[model samples]
Target: MRIIGRALAAMVLLVTAAVAGAVEEDGYELWMRYRPLDKAAQSALQPRATALVYSGTASPTAQAAISELQRGFGGMLGKVPAADTQLRNGAIVLATPASMPELAKGLEALGSEGYQLRSTVVQGKKLTVIAANSDKGLLYGAFALLRAVGTGAKLDALNTSSAPKLQLRLLNHWDNLDRTVERGYAGESIWDWWRLPDIRDRRYTDYARANASLGINGTVLNNVNSKPEILTAPWIAKAAAVADVLRPYGIKVYLSARWSTPLELKETKTADPLAPEVAEWWTRKADEIYRAIPDFGGFLVKANSEGQPGPQDYHRSHADGANMLARAVAPYKGIVMWRAFVYAHEKPVDRARQAYDEFKPLDGTFLPNVMVQVKNGAIDFQPREPFHPLFGAMPKTPLMMEFQITKEYLGFSTHMAYLGAMYEETLREDTQQKPGGFTVAQVLEDKDHGQRLTGMAGVANIGSERNWSGSHFDQANWYAYGRLAWDPQASARELAREWAAQTFTPDPRVTGPVVDMMMLSREAVVNYMTPIGLHHLMGTGHHHGPAPWVDSLGRPDWNPVYYHKADRQGVGFDRTATGSDALAQYAAPIARQYADPRTTPAKYLLWFHHLPWDYAMPSGRTLWAEMIAHYDQGVGEAKDLRARWEKLKPFIDARRHEDTANLLDVQVKEAQWWRDACIAYFQSVSGKALPQGVKAPARTLDYYKSLHFPYAPGRG
Candidate 1:
């Protein structure tokens, strides 16, 4: 009897081990993996997905949606749902008023690109239906349905619909012609430019599919630092070929135009916006591009920012440059996205106040088809920034929000910082405009005036890396950015949970801890690298690692010391009225609220006010002690993220699990490095001893300051 019991116990142990072992995968599929669910979920979903019934004309968009459904069902339920002409029990239907008039009642309210998914009964047979106003909507609906199934949502109770709030959802690829990506931590550029026009890579279709799944309908194929030759004939053919691959998936291709392209081409003497020859050259170029691409999206111009040439070179306003391009594309119904990130010519009193000072007065000057694209922050893309003042300041203009998906300021790709929290923070900021305050998200959706254009642009993190984004976890930022761009009001925490379920496994044991880790990761980075509103303290050129003592740069603003202003007295930038008065750029309510350091949120204390080291914090500790505690807490959190991932090993495939584990190892070291180096540098400046119970930095300030990484990835 004892021998028989031992044999049964061993059999149970073997079965348990098999259940925990997921198949090896390299994370190439991203959230679209659609791997088979657990037994209970598979059993519950299989019956509802017995057949696909769509009698509508299979347009390219429709065909794409149908193919995705088949792929998702085949992967998830172990069989591709058969296509049937007649509706049957357990069938999934794609419907429009033209295809199935009976099921199109609620679809009208869901605009052209919106969709509705519901479980309904037809002739006493229960089935699922994805109804939309157009084929594009059906495509988006199909992706939403797959997301539901992958996340293990109940099929019987499926009833949800979505419409993108913003009109233009785009990925801005800062990829150069030579294939090097600016601020791209992921491998080389995804566009195989050298071989593009003739030998199209299968990856292009996959890229379109990925973007379409998230409702991202546009992509700028080159770097914002535009080259003149891209407008030449040879490059137009390459762009047209890529655009063909993307068009069927409802995506349009946009190009970044060099302001001085005509001058460089020797077609015009001066690149001045008002000059007839310059205008004529652009018009002719636009006509040439449209002839090749036809459905091309308009240009994204980074004029007068950095060293990029613009109408500013001719002493003309930004409106003059943007309007010239707008007129060129207007005949083709294309819109111009004029970037509002202007600086670097002459040092301003406060760099944070530059864009608002320049743009606020010209709010009503831009043409209807032109959108002033503003970055999320007043400054560059810091880890945490107050929403750009232009959001509230320019009610007359249609402003588009630009978010950096690339981790330029946050630790580049390897660090486990989930940026959904950062995006959510900026989106949820109260602009505090007169009459009634509006959140930054609300500001983007505003249409009180006759304005029509509304959008959100994310700087692309995608590359030739097999995983798309450099690290496994970094892909979540790309996913979250797309989801948020669709609906700015969406919750970051919920988005993280959804991403966790689809990317890894739907099992609670895997998703719960993973989401927790993601939610904590961004804050962990902020705490270690730039806690309590400390901004832009990274090394000069590469923008990697810590270099708080870097003060040798030619321009004052180029140095980390210029921003932090750490001395023997205090650390932090002072934007108060007494200092730079950058805070005055906000609405009066916000300015009044942030005018006093004590009333300011601790998260943004140092951004607006500079205080003494011994100043009392709300935590009952001196400012010095609180800063030390935050650094210590961040190091512990980084370690905790690794430990959490370790526990999730059983639920994930071996390759992906190990990749994340290895990256987490790197994250812990980097987080520790950032903590130790910053604390060392700050302590030296403050002349303060280590606070009680806080560990001293492992190295001296000189040791950290002496270290340099000249060959860091992602440098321009």
Candidate 2:
């Protein structure tokens, strides 16, 4: 009778807790969750971390470091360690040479943003010291310390030194004035433009913390397709309000300014770069912005590209447009990020060749502060594309890497495609520009190129969703981008492992399966969606699902048929000597290899050279057979990924675990859909039969084409 009463009491307690909403972890905590550690491990490490000491002036950035450390320790260890000015045994000390003269000599090696963290006995006191040249570096060091502990690094034996490889690491938000995000899948834009100047959201603080944790320093707050009002007086005040919050975290706010802003705002008759009134208007605008936000990072302009106005509208070159804005901001130490994505689809030539054709000849003409932002590939962010020819081609101008993090071409936020592997592939590709002298990274770092500044930008996937990014896994891509931007040479696999450990659990069993799933994710998306060099085969408008059969769009570039060129005689676009000769745009070695279908790497075979359906591949299978096999392989990978996530249920929290499990289920279903939809359309165009062992597509081409998502998220 007593035992039954006890059981009944426990059941009541459980029900009451559920009714009151016992903590359900939505992923708003990102990698900085700092959740409580396992009791046994916490007990073991507690003695080694008995004290915390900071001997520096309490600058806002330095205080941020102290506060973050306290929060991390409190959550992870179940108690905040003692804080003091004097170092003690087992103390974790943060100091700059300016504060601690004893640490001054060693800190000279670490640059302004660099820091050295080491464990040693100082004055007979065994301690861990994070010494840097400045307080900003101390804040970065603090985050690094928390990251190490969260990822299971031993604090007692810590020894590490680090600095950023790139000077500018930025997130380009495609958020519009109306809070509608272009290509954003998570939710509405996080920026509440209507209430910014008066009401600062706490989410803004969390956003700054997240970026600082990863060493990201800049953010462009609006879409490249920007409205002129963003540059007006009202918006400048709002920007200042947000900037004040982010300043202490070491992040600067940038804006995407319209090239025709002066005209659009009715401040000038024309926006021609050479026009004196237009030049005066931009100069005044820069002055106004700088006066409000003293450290405002300048404009990101998308010009005569996509019908946006530019110098070209008045018969001037891209250099003229970029330089005019550069001069205006030069007085205030701001930059102009001029996009190199301009292309004319009206031209019959290959779309891949157009950017280089327009910008190559005027390479040396851009001003020092003008960074020509080039997309990772010559074509838009496809599933797979060769590195852009412009990377090492234009040595005289500074070029910034623009990688899209929104997954616009890779099935948005629903699909589980990790982009770390994709970034590593492009960053490592050898440009072979001058007799083995340069890689893509090397070109940007080169002093001879007159590159006073170098940077990388990612199109942000962040939104108002509780998880930050739409899916739990999509957060990994955002984390990966910031880490890569800080150090271009870092390994994606290592980044994935660290992120998996910090984000989910440090347990080998949980992290092992997660990392394995992430490593192969992007390849699986490529296999099912485009396979071996096919590009941009999604729906005409929303870019959701497949519609490779669509032929009648306004412009040829907007149609999938124009890209793939699948026909009864052959399949694949011919960019070789016989067709558009786009291969010639690359250096001699690359051009020579891609000139022939047989010589090109099988992964990029169809991209550079078109081939017949019956052409034999190195895999000892016919081209049609190989493509079908790839599609089948991708579907299998998706199923495997879903199964792998199920194994993590024992380790992950119930809420996050279930969310990821459901998303993975969607990924598997979509993978099959992508495979079937693409295969059906190609078969119709090529008039080919499936290989003997390969299964037929699940539906007809017309049925797949009939699947429309006119109301898909992120179609603003």
In candidate 1, position 501 carries an lDDT of 90
Tens digits of per-residue lDDT for model 2, 1-716: 99999999999999988954534678888899887889987986686567778874688888888888888888899899888898788888887777876754576656788878888787888888888898889888989999998999887788899988788899999999899999999999988999989999999999998999999989999999999999989999988998998988889999999999989888899989999999999999899999999999999999988778889889999999999999999999999999999877667678899999999999899999999999999989888889999999887888999999999989899989999999989998898888855777776566564428899999999999999999889999999999999888889999999899888889999888899999989999999888889888898889988888889888888899888888888778888889998888888998997887888888998787678899998899999999999999999988988888888888887888899888888889988999998888888888898889778878887788788787988876
Clashing pairs in 2: none
lDDT of 1 by residue, 564-609 (tens): 8988888778898789998998989889999998999999898887
Q: What lDDT does the true structure give each of the candidates? A: 0.90, 0.88
Candidate 1's C-alpha runs over 4 A off are 1-22
Best by lDDT: 1
Question: TM-scores of all models?
Answer: 0.96, 0.97
Best by TM-score: 2
